[model samples]
Target: MSVSSQHEGLCLRYPEPLGPQANVSYEAAVSMLMRAIQLAQHTPFVWGYIDKPQEGHIYLIFMTQQLPFPPDGIRYQDQEQKIIMPAGPGRELEVMEVKFGFVPNSSDTTAWRVRRRYRMHKGGHPQLVLIHYGRGQPMPIMPNLNQPVRNYPLRPINEPALFVMGEKIGQKVYPNQHSGPAERPGPPGMGMSFGGIGNQQAMLAQQNNNLEALERRSQRDRSGSMNARAPPPARIEDDDSADESDMMSTRTLALTRYKRNHELMNEVFMYAAFSRKKEFPPPKSPYSVFDIANVEARVAKMTAEIDELRSKAEARREARSNADGAVGDDPGDVSMEVSGTTEEVPT
Candidate 1:
């Protein structure tokens, strides 16, 4: 089947062979063009021909990345005219009229020779466009507009697997809500008075403390039991083979631990590098564990030092000002004495 036949539902009503001219409605033509462009998004390339018998032309619509300029004598507000059409429910498709062709020739197939003009309707309806082309011109060759294949980054071989037991690695698995302890009943007269609410809160706190203590005790007991049951160290054998086997086992264990630690260190370095480049916020320090007393003592010491320095600077300035004033007074005194001597000599 022909491409047009395959997309018959798209409302493209073009004849198979080229007659002198083929007649198609403006609405059907626009619908076919929009649909073809929409399908081209998923494919590498798509092109189709629409016959406008009324204008005596055949339009060659093809996907292209380059913006086409308008022919001479025709001016547009923008280099490419954009037309918005409804694609699907709650969706709009934007189509650009990149190129306009006026002159038609049989030799150059690459040049767009058909003028595609859009007309807006009076009422709220689908807009229509009139395409003009030469009557006997053959279909133009499809442009080489295939999109370049994208190159995506591959995961590193050393990167750990991201799946575990049908769950993503490092994904938090929260305990089921039903599996948690049942909600305790509020104290008698709870929510009626503040005292009742306080009592209930205190009771809950005590219960939580008791549970934590029990858990800690059980853990300690389990560790003690395990330690007590541990077998005594094996006696050294005189045989060389036994000693060699023991050494080999110890070396293997050490190597295994070193490898594990190396992997962990690599993960930490990678995270630190990424965090630095990304400028992630530093983790907040716990206020409960902060040494507020030590900070306050240091701050007090700094304040005292600052005050002492300020006092010393003030004293130095005061001394300098006093010395300046004394020097000025001496100069005035000497001048006055010289004037008195001159007056006496004249007498």
Candidate 2:
């Protein structure tokens, strides 16, 4: 595999197997593996793995360096293996399981039985487990391996750095050593030096004197400005009183305007309701003689006149009804007397 510049000269060891007893979730295991890969980008070597040593559990072992086995005893046979690469950004890791008919001669039949049981558990489907290598490649078959193992170029997983103590995750921590004590910061307006304490003291005293002189000048300037800007007590009181009177006058004028507008609106409504023609007059200007108190007194007088008119109309209707009843009763009496006179004439 062609190594990138960042991974050049760095050899990664075989990743150690992780089992169920480790109490690590699948996501946490993947995170740990990715973190190790990130560290390997800057360091010489890193080791990581993802596997559970149980039936139906898949194995993903990562290694950059050559295997440490004897070349003659281990034969590398080519087998069909699928490679899963991230399609785009923000894609999760995907795993593919394939069936491997070729089993190693070194392993006992118990391993093959477990494999069969796992396949049976999966409903007799082919067991094909593919690792997330950068590119597609064939897996190397070896003796004494019950499962298929693949090797491909290493690519860093896109993820945030893991939280690890005493180490800067995703960054290199270089050892910075000093041959002597750290240089302390010198006083203001002074250069740092290792020698000549007497010279430093003299420079410090001079700086203090300059600062004191500047402070005294600033104080004198502030006092002079204050005295020049301050107004006389009597003048200040007069200005305050004038501002208060102006505010009061403005408030009173605004209130009078509001009351006049309100009265005008009330007059318009009353005229619209009670006028003979039911027509509203044109609006007048604000400066027109429209007194709120005069409008209120007129409204009261109109209300009293309406009440008196209603009472008089009711009394006249009552008196007309009584006069009509009296006239009808007299006609009935006259008809009775005429009938009596006719009866006496017949006798």
RMSD of each: 30.3, 30.2
Predicted model with the maximum lDDT:
1
What lDDT tens digits, residue by residue, belong to model 1 across residues 1-347? 13232232112111111112233334433443443232222111111223212234433222111212212222112245666665445444444453433222223443343344433222211222223332233343434422211112211122111111111112211223110111122233321111112344454444344434433443454466457676534533222244223222343335445876889899999888776555568788778576999989999999999999999999999999999988877633222346446433332
In candidate 1, stretches whose alpha carbon ends up further than 4 angstroms from where it belongs are: 1-30, 34-58, 63-86, 89-287, 290-347
Tens-digit lDDT track of model 2 for 1-347: 23341233222222222121212223332333343343222222132323222332323222212322111111223333433334234433433323323334434232221111111112111111213211112343434564433323434432222112112212212224110111122244321111222454453454345434433443454466457675423322122243223222343335445876889899999888777765678998885788888999999999999999999999999999999989877633222346447433332
Residue 240 C-alpha lDDT in model 1: 28
Taking all chains together, the TM-score of candidate 1 against the true structure is 0.19
Q: Model 1: which residue pairs collide?
A: 57-133
Score residue 139 of candidate 1 by CA lDDT: 40
Model 2 lDDT at residue 182: 11
TM-score, every prediction: 0.19, 0.24
lDDT of every model, 2 decimals: 0.35, 0.34
TM-score of 2: 0.24
